[model samples]
Target: MNVLEFLDSPELTPGTFEGDTWEPWRAVLSGAFGLPMDKGRARLFKRLSGGRKAPTSRVRELLVLAGRRSAKSNTSAAVAVYLATIGAEMDGLLDKLKPGERGVVGLIAVDRAQAKVLFRYIEGIFDASPVLSKLVSKRGAESIDLNNRVSLEVHTNSFKAVRGRTMIAALLDEACFYADENSASPDVELYRAIVPSLATTGGLLIAISSPWARKGLMYQKWKKHYGKNSDVLVVQGGTQDFNPTIDPRVIKEALEDDPEGARSEWLGQFREDISDFMRRDVVEQAARVEPLELPPCADTRYFGFADPAGGGKDEFTMAIGHRDGERVVVDVVRGRRGTPAQIVEEYAALFKDYRVSRITSDRFAGSWPADEFKKHGITCDQSAKPKSQLYVDSLARFNSGQVEIPPEDKLITQFCNLERRTARGGRDSVDHPSGGHDDRANAVAGLLAEAATRPANIIFECLDDGYEPEWHPYQMFS
Candidate 1:
């Protein structure tokens, strides 16, 4: 039986869905899969159609873009389980597996907590069904083993974790926010890693997420492939369109407070508040394939800048660089998290190693940074401008190809994700997207800005103090 039918069966939900509890989803998926729909649903389908008609062909891939509380996670979990079970009856799903190999159905989420939510839904569905439950051979915190040699696994979004698996199907939940705490490009990296594995098995890949920024793999796919008549299907809808059960007042309050965010979260539109400040291609073009870590050179004068965090949630980052004639060459970048005193002491030692005379820092913790550096006999100069200005100045260097960046993935990700926001007054500012960090980028910008703008420290002295030269208009002209 199909997933929607199974959901309505007596063994599963019983009589919970009476009239049109699932009618919207039924129409959507029927159109997606090219199955016949009832007249009412068919009309709804036509109204919701995008670039092409609902074809009579099978869909090989699907991308569902919907608002929050729109039954996306539940629908994704149901579809994943269906592919792992009912779809298994098809040829080549289990036929290609070796004697000791097992087919896997993967459920990936933005984080561990989100992954667990979907895993629980899948687990509950299996445990509640008598027929489906008989296939269970083992169950763990994040995986379920069936007697038929198939495994259902749950994981946080990561390319390394998903590699080498022979998947029957994979469900990516809330994929727009797939970035981990430390990563900047989780969506692209994870997607690229999983696609090759699917090629061998012809497994279905479903990415369901609420609309986010106008970038990343989700946005790119929708921009390029949505409404196209192909194996890939991109479905877009708002909260009311998909799940009318959500309270209208909840969405109303959200819209009244922040219209842009509300539209992205509840209306299923990409945010106008979010965009890239520096293009990814520009950043990549300027970065070295492999970064260099150089020891202190006796001839070159080095400089350091720190973008201090409280050492709590954010990172305590520092950048070290030197002016190479007209250009700034970044030598090293370091970040650590700890108590304020501990971080200060660590940076003190690093400063001594580079023979740094003075360090520049943002005004973090008021006068504490200056006071703490005093303990180490180092002068901490607070920047006159905000971090946004630092990014703006650094952007010019990047655009002119004057600065060569290190090959740090985190640094590159931060730069790529940085957004240039223009307020209603025509004032502009640059910063990272929500849940992202720009500590490394900030530190580097500070270091490069000083290098580009600061003049060389040259002390003038007179060797011929006893002699004075005569000044005349004719002699000066000659």
Candidate 2:
């Protein structure tokens, strides 16, 4: 039977989909598989199709960009399970698989937590039906072996991890927010890796995620393929468009807190407020294979910068670097979470060991960082310029290869996710993306800025008369 019919089975799967709760998904699925949708659902499908016409033929690829808690994971899991169990029985699907070859299905997530959610959904669906359960030859912690020779695997979001697999179908959950480390862009790397593998098996690829930045594979596809009536179906909708159960009051509350973030998270709209500030190629070119843990060299004058969090949700981070000709080589990066007094004591000792008597900070908790550092006979100076200026100078250094950073994942991620927000008067500001922290990036940038401003390393100095600066770098939106 078709997937819609299977899900709508009254006796066997009655409560699987409540009345109209899954109608939008069912409509999309019916269009994808060339099944018939009721007139009401057909109209609903057209209105929410994001400009693509339903194909008379089968859909080989699909991209769904919807808001969070919109039941995207459940829909993706359902599709994955259906393809695993029923693809072999379908004429065109598993017929492409090589003889005696088990078709591989992948459910990939940005992290373990998301992977677990998808894994459990598939597991629960299989467990609900005895008929479907009989198809499992083996069940694993994050995978299942179907008697039909289809191997289902759950994976963290890494293209390298999924390379060389013969896939029947792959679902990329929350693909837009796939954090990047080594690669310039995780979504692009994953797409480049999985798309070629699927060609061999003539398999299906489905990427579903809430709209994030205007970059990455999801955004690129949305711009290029969406509403073009092509083989790849790209659909965009708000949370309520697909899942009507989401309360409007909850969305209102989110919008009240952060309009830009809320729009992308619940309104299913790509954010215009954020874009990548630093180029990935430049950042990657400067990263060392390992972070330097060496002590201060006798001849090298070290500079230190700290982003203290005082045992809060954010990290307390410090970066130390020294000048070498025109280039600044980051020597050490230390980060931890602890009580304010403890963190201050530990970092003070480290700074002293590096021969750093005075350090730069962002003025944490109004004199606490300075007062605490004073206890250890260390001077903490509030940064003269804004953090935004530090980032701007750091970007300039990176573009010129004037700075070398350690190959730290946290630092790389923070740098890669940094956003350049521009205002109406053409004033530009830089900061981390929504739900992203830049403590390490901030420390590193601050250190680079500190090194560049040294009298020995000054490249250019500009003094303006009668110029009033009202905005600090830290007051981004303000």
Candidate 3:
């Protein structure tokens, strides 16, 4: 089949594709992969084949959430080759301006070396196959150009370089890892910046990777974009779903061989990599079982905090706080799963009784509860950043001694168990350590964000010159 035929193929498999038509170049790629040239391969091709769709391309933003070792890389390689051919074959969905009007297509990874790996995969694939090999004009580790109009260039995860060059399409591989590296990342800044080149001019963005830790731009977007956005297509397959080489029995054996690797590579999890960030031990050290002393005469601004979840086993956490100038000390109020009504009544009562200035929580999957707070006249909004970021923000303050938490604070126990998970493309996440206290971690974040902003004054009359630090963790959650 002609590469241009694959690039401009109009033949649609009636029920297979919903968005865009097939690019002829991609059809050639499917044939190479032994994928039948029929509707049957439409889902697989969209999932495994096309790059950001060109004029005849089917997808716009490709968000693939496959599991580890699921042939994600191999499938990704096929798409790269397809794009290279399209770029080489024609104007790449650009105007039919004679020829050579379209600029270069970008293949980005975490670094130049990794980018070369993908570039080389496509290069090698074409070099091996007679049909694909013909399109290969010049091939190297960093680049593969076809005919004249199209060029496939590999790049490290540098948003700057990516932004500088114009393109018909761009592919982001190992999204989870890059997201890890994008902490305060200019690269991420670049991704947001470059969206217009396509959104305005009609180009494509392909983001494909197994998950890394659960923080940063990719995770943040993945968390939100998949369910809500119409333009985004999120595809996921476990090792069993996408992996071509690994057998089910062998996969099970591999999991048994190394439970940690199994959790990360196959399950795309970050549990094993997290722990040891919070100053819980310090809180514990500062804790003491003091008597119920007389109350201080000065007024205090206390805040009851909560961390909402999007279900699937994430916790519903709450914390009550009192601000003393720079620091707002908090105690865990409640952390569990229940109806919005249950959560609101408990936190509201705590807020009123404690006279907390406000109540805050993460704006995630808890629509009903967050609304419930609104109905009751409670202040509520989503955390501006990820839990990891909030964790970092709070930790930075605590480390500088800018914030203070007595050992007796029940919330500190939850903080101590937080974990930083490993993500694809070198990203990491800060969550309650596996089987630890996420609710506690989230509550602290709420307290921290509130403190940094405009806050009420505290008339600090030392209520307890000597403190009582006896805190029972188990009973406190209730």
lDDT head-to-head 1 vs 3, winner: 1
Off by over 4 Å in 2: 37-40, 91-101, 249-257, 282-298, 308-317, 323-354, 365-389, 396-413, 421-429, 434-437, 457-478
In the order shown, the candidates' Cα RMSDs to the true structure are 5.5, 7.9, 17.4
> In candidate 3, residue 415 scores what lDDT?
63
Arranged by lDDT with the best first, the candidates are: 2, 1, 3
Best by lDDT: 2
TM-score, every prediction: 0.89, 0.80, 0.47
Clashing pairs in 1: none
TM-score of 2: 0.80
lDDT of each: 0.78, 0.80, 0.55
Model 3 Cα lDDT, one tens digit per residue, 1-478: 4433443334411222223333322442443323345664555544432332211334456666666665555546656666556533443354532354545667778655667677666665665566656656776657776764566777766666666455667778776565221122333665775675455335567777766555545666666655342455454445655544557786688678866657656765443454357555454543334421212223544555677654455556676655556555554345666665776777666555555435666756456656777766576666667667887777777666655543434355556555666554467667753223456557767777767774445333323421211223332110
Query: Model 2, poorest ten-residue lDDT window?
Result: 460-469
Write candidate 1's Cα lDDT for 232-308 as tens digits.
Answer: 77878889988888899999999988788799999999887767799888888878777456677654567789888
lDDT of 2 at 275: 77
Q: How much lDDT does candidate 3 score?
A: 0.55
Model 2, span 1-478: residue lDDT tens: 7878767765435477768788888887876776776779778777677656677766788888898888999888877887887754673667777788777899999888888998999988888887788888999899999988788899988898678778888999999888653455777888889988888877888999999879989998889887778778888889998888989999999998878878999999998877789887788888887645666654445778988785665788998888777788898887788787898999888887766778898754457889899998788898877888889888888999988888787787788778898654568899876445788899998898788676443232212321111222342110
